[model samples]
Target: MSPERYARINQMLDNRQTDLTLCLDTVHKTQNIAAVIRTADAVGIHQIHAVWPDAEMRVSGNTASGSQQWVKTLQYSSMSEAAKQFNLQGMQVLATNFSDKAVDFRDIDYTKPTVVIMGNERDGVSDEGLAIADQHIIIPMLGMVQSLNVSVASALIMYEAQRQREQAGMYGTRQLDEAYCQKMLFEQGHPIYAKACRRKNIPYPSIDAQGQIEANATWWQRMREPDPNADEA
Candidate 1:
């Protein structure tokens, strides 16, 4: 990688938020998904958990631009499964839904570990998602239209989260785990090398300060070595 590219990768990895994430519940529109991914990357969100049981999750290249290549998007077979994972991590799962019990979006403390859920295009948050959410939040509307587009709503809510985290000094220092950061750098800086490492079920070779791989012939031979205890197939 070029020195400039290495510096850019380091800067992004350093500022990436570990606790903040997005959850999409059965949202199927390509453009909407693309927009959400773009906004999440802008706000330093590293991963997006999506529950799309009925459709294969795909992002549009045009709408996402290059963000589809940067941010990680994880697909889940069910909302309950996704919610359980985030809840286990102590995340405050807030679903975007308009309800009598819902709180204002701006009122929540976004500085804490949070997973903001964006509902499907037509139905909004699923019943399962609402049941799993720690809280339900809504963006106040002024016009005759009751609610904003899913992507638009997502951008507003995410930027608010970014603002709160920034005020709390979360963005001033590195938050991602070092081990994970190394893996990300390997994947981003030298994708083909990273793929080979994965193919061999071996840990990725270390990345130098210049964002270049430290892989050598010894590393490849080590990865190709057979397991000593393997039984006859």
Candidate 2:
């Protein structure tokens, strides 16, 4: 990796919002998915969970414009599975939907660990998704339109979350742990060599200040040895 490239990656990782995440349920449109991904990246969200059980979430190159590469999208086979994992992590699940019990989006305490869920564009949040949600939030409608598009709704809620977090001084310093920061930097900046280290069952070779690996070192030579676990072809 070049010095500039490494610096840029490090900067992003430093500011990443580890407590915030987004979830989508059965949103199959590629353009819509891409738009959400783009907005999530803009708000410093590092991870997005998407549930599209029948098919992989697809995004067009034009729509993504490389935003998908910066954000990690995790696919779940069901909404329950995703909800369970987020619940285990102590994240509050807020679903976007129209309901008698729903509250205004801005009224919630977004500074807490939260996962905002968006459902299908036409049907709104599914019964299953809503059941697992800690709360139902609605973007108030002023015009003739009853609700905003999924991507637009996502952006609004995300920025609100960012605003609350910023007020609480969440963005003033690094939130990610040191070990995670190092792991993401290597996996994203030096993918090929990181994979090699994983395959060889060795620790990742450390990079110099300039982001270049020491290619001819004694430790590296030892790290290149093949494992002898008897899984021969």
Candidate 3:
């Protein structure tokens, strides 16, 4: 990536809070999954936990539009397992469903560490998923349709979170801790080099905000030079 691009990413990263996440429970449609992932990234969600029985989920390049690369997508076989993990991390899981206990979506506190759980396209959230949710939320619908698409619902909830966070200054500086910001900036700046280093279990050379090599500058400089071994006229 160019230096300017790297700077922009770092700026966004500085405003990325890991407190909020999205959880998809057995959502079968690839397009819906892709759309949700795209919206999650757009709203600066840190991670997405997706639970499917088998590893049949796939996102088309056209549908996902490279958003998956920016957002961390984690897969689990069981909704219980995903819920367990998040709960262990002290995150409150809120499922979207219609129930007597369901509260208005606008009333929920988005400033807390939260996981917005969405259910299948047809059946809605699984019973097990609902059982573990800290709260249930419903978007009041007055139209005849009575329900929105899973992707649209997710976008609505996530953008509302974005709005709330923006209001609370949650999107301000210190969104990501210092260590994470540095690591993400390094990876974004040198993706190929980062992958190569990971494959070899080596640490990638660091780069500053201007995209200048920080560690082992001599090594990178030598590699950039033309090979004298090649035959030339």
Question: Model 2: per-residue lDDT, tens digit, 1-233?
Answer: 87788998777876789779998988887888999999998889988999888987777767898888778899999998898889888999999988999999999999889998899888988889999998999999989989888988999999999898888888747877777766777777788878777767767665566767645676577666675543889
Q: In candidate 1, what are the lDDT values of residues 1-233, reduced to their tens digit? A: 78887888888887788789989989898999999999999999988999989878978777799898778999999988897789788999999998888999999999889999899889999999999888899999888999888999999999999999888888858877888888878888888767666666677888898787788898878666765445769
Candidate with more favorable, higher TM-score: 1 or 2: 1
Candidate 1 has its poorest 10 consecutive residues by lDDT at 223-232
**TM-scores of all predicted structures:** 0.86, 0.83, 0.86
User: What range of 10 consecutive residues in model 3 has the weakest lDDT sum?
Assistant: 221-230
Q: Following a full C-alpha superposition, what root-mean-square deviation does model 3 have from the true structure?
A: 4.0
- Which regions in candidate 3 have their CA more than 4 angstroms from the true location? 177-180, 195-202, 217-233
| Pairs in clash, predicted candidate 1 | none
Which is the leading candidate under lDDT? Answer: 1
Number of clashing pairs per prediction, in order: 0, 0, 0
What are the root-mean-square deviations of the candidates from the true structure over C-alphas?
A: 4.8, 4.1, 4.0
lDDT of 3 by residue, 1-233 (tens): 78687878876686676889988999989899999989888888877989998876788878999887778788899987897789787988899999999998989999889998999998999998999999999999998887899999999999898999999987757666666666777777777767655555555565675765577766566555555554686
